[model samples]
Target: MKLLIGNKCYSSWSLRAWLLMRAAGIAFTEELVPLDTPDFKETVFAAAPGSGGTVPVLVDGGIAVWETLAIVEYLHERFPESGIWPRDPAARAHARAAANEMHAGFTALRGACPMNLGKRFGPRDRGPGVARDVERLAALWGQARERFGAGGPFLYGAFCAADAMFAPVVTRLDTYGIAVDPLSRDYMQAVLAHPAFREWLTAALAEPAIVAQDEVDEPALVDLRKS
Candidate 1:
């Protein structure tokens, strides 16, 4: 298996997919491509199936999976014993719904927070859209923790697809220094303490490919430390 990712410092989708693969104990050769550069499109086009030039492309044997969710599904199918999704049908369905919601929704939070792992900033200057997204995220985390997190600290307990889907969101929250209640904070801690997440952060901290545009968009007093 070959995993093509973007710069670990800024590519949230790549982080999610890489964390999922690591959690599943799937060993693969990793290729990191710096995003938004002049050669980025050419590199991705050469490696990917089509001309989308997207990051987080997974090459499994002869097959290429592009989208993050699709790549995760492919991994789950290839390694059933890894338990990427739940065994129970109802739990699995709920997990899929949550993951899909994360994939398509939360535009406001994603746009405002933009995952820069361990970056810190004041929350006072956020927009209404960002505030609303934070509220919704906290509510969702509380509900999931109360319902399915009985077995462990993760959303679906034992770190399933749902948790993997929200791992980037955890990074966003931490990066922006968003404060939540006890439940959400605990969940965030679980995400931060995960070994795969730590590995990603370690690599991200070492990366020197600084996108000036991304850095300028963030708060001036922010710190990009591995939380």
Candidate 2:
């Protein structure tokens, strides 16, 4: 299987699919197409003909699955023993719901603070929209951890598709210096410290390609990419 993704530094969606597969030990080769390049659309379209020219397209032989959620489902179905989702039926349902909510919601925070792994910003009041989004995120995470995360630090005990879905959100919270409750903070720490996340972050920092839109206007407190 070959997963076609975008730049590690700026592609949050790509990180979702890549992190899930990598953490699950699902062996698959990856191809990175730097975003905003001249032939990005063409390259993605060629690789995933009907994917709406998006990143994180997983191609397994003749089957090409696009969209991060679809990719998660595909992998879960393909490798049931991989434990991509939770083993319990209730936990599995909640995990899927949480992942889908992440997929569709949280545009306010996403717009205010795009996921940039190389820089850290001093937190400030972005806006009411951002504040609301952050509040919701914390509550959502807290709910998951309280209900199903006793087995491990992740949302659903062990790292699963739901954690993969929110992994980039974890980056956004840390990068923008957004504060969360202790539970959420601990969950975020676990995500950031994960081996899969560390591998992705290291590669992201080394990436020279910069997406201008994703780069915020605020001055960065720490620019680790320069260091």
Candidate 3:
């Protein structure tokens, strides 16, 4: 399997798929393509013929899979024992619902807090849209941790596909210094301290490419490249 991802610092979708595969201990080679480059479009199309100029494309054998959620589902089906989803059917269904919600919802928070692994900034005034999104996310995470995540710190207590699905959001909240409830904060810390997350962040810090458009926060900036 060969996974093609974008710049680790800014590509949320790439981070999601990469974390899932890494956490599952899937043996696969990775190809990193710097985003927003002159030949980025060409690189994507050439690497993933099915990717309509987007990223986190996983190619297994001869099959190319784009779309983070689709790639995740494919992995789960291909390796059922990998425990991508929960072992319990009801828990699996609940996890699926959260992942799907993350995939198709949270536009406001996503727009406001794009993940930037190599950068840190001071807190900013949260807009109403982003604030609402944050509140909803905190509530969901709080409830999930209480109801289903009793075995461990992850959403389902075992770092399943559901955890990978929200890993970027963890980074986003941390990057922006967004305050959440205690339960959500602890969950975020658990994800932040995961080995796979650290690996990705380290790689991202080493990347030299700087896509200017993604540098949204400017106050008291510190580059993790030097950290």
Candidate 4:
């Protein structure tokens, strides 16, 4: 199996898929394709069946799979022992819901706070849409952790598809210095401490390409390092 990803610093979708592959102990070779390059479109088309300039395409047995959530589900189906999703059916349903919501929703927050792994940034002047999204995220995370996260620190005990889905949001909250509740903040810390996440962050810091528009200077990076 092989995974094609974009610049580690800027591509949230890539981060999600890559993190899942690592955390699940799925063995896959990684191919890093820098975004916005002239060959990226052609490269994406050649690599994945339906992807058009999209990052994080997984190639397995000569088959290509795009879409972060779909790739995660594929991994879960292909390697059940990998434990990509929760074991229980009800928990699995809730996880799927969270993953789906993370994949399709949160447009405002996404637009306002693009993930910059190496940088510490302050939150922007959030509009109504962004505010609502943050509130919804807090509620969802808090409720999930309260109900399902009994055995471990992740959303549903062990790190699963839902964690992969929202891994970018965790970065967004930290990078933008968005103040979430204690539950959400603690969850974010847990994500940051994941070994796979730290590995990803190290790679992101090593990238050379710069998306200038993505950089913003506002308040200040609030270090969330656990003391």
Can you give the TM-score per candidate against the true fold? Answer: 0.94, 0.98, 0.96, 0.93
Candidate 3 residue runs with Cα over 4 Å from true position = none
Per-prediction tally of clashes: 0, 0, 0, 0
Q: Between prediction 3 and prediction 4, which has the larger TM-score?
A: 3
Give one digit per residue, the lDDT tens place, for model 4 in 1-227.
99999888888999999999899999999998888788987888888756766988999988899988789888988999888999989889999999999988999999988787767765566788889999999999988998899979999999998998999999888887788999999999999999999999877887778866566545445422211
- In order, the Cα lDDT scores of the candidates are 0.83, 0.93, 0.88, 0.87
Ordered from best to worst TM-score, the candidate numbers read: 2, 3, 1, 4
- Residue pairs with clashing backbones, model 2: none
TM match of model 4 to true structure: 0.93
Kindly list the per-residue Cα lDDT of model 2 for residues 180-208, writing each as its tens digit.
Answer: 98988999999999999999999999998
- Candidates 2 and 4: which is better by lDDT? 2
Tens digits of lDDT, candidate 1, 59-112 = 877788888999889988899989799877777787898899899988988887
Cα error, residue 71 of model 1, in Å, equals 0.4
List the pairs of residues colliding in candidate 1: none
lDDT of 1 at 189: 95
- Highest TM-score: give the candidate number: 2
lDDT of 3 by residue, 20-113 (tens): 9999999899998888888887988887785787898999987989899999999999999897999988788989999999999999988877
Arrange candidates by lDDT, descending.
Answer: 2, 3, 4, 1
Q: Cα deviation in Å at residue 143, candidate 2?
A: 1.2
Best by lDDT, which number?
Answer: 2
Looking at model 3, residue 108 earns an lDDT score of: 92
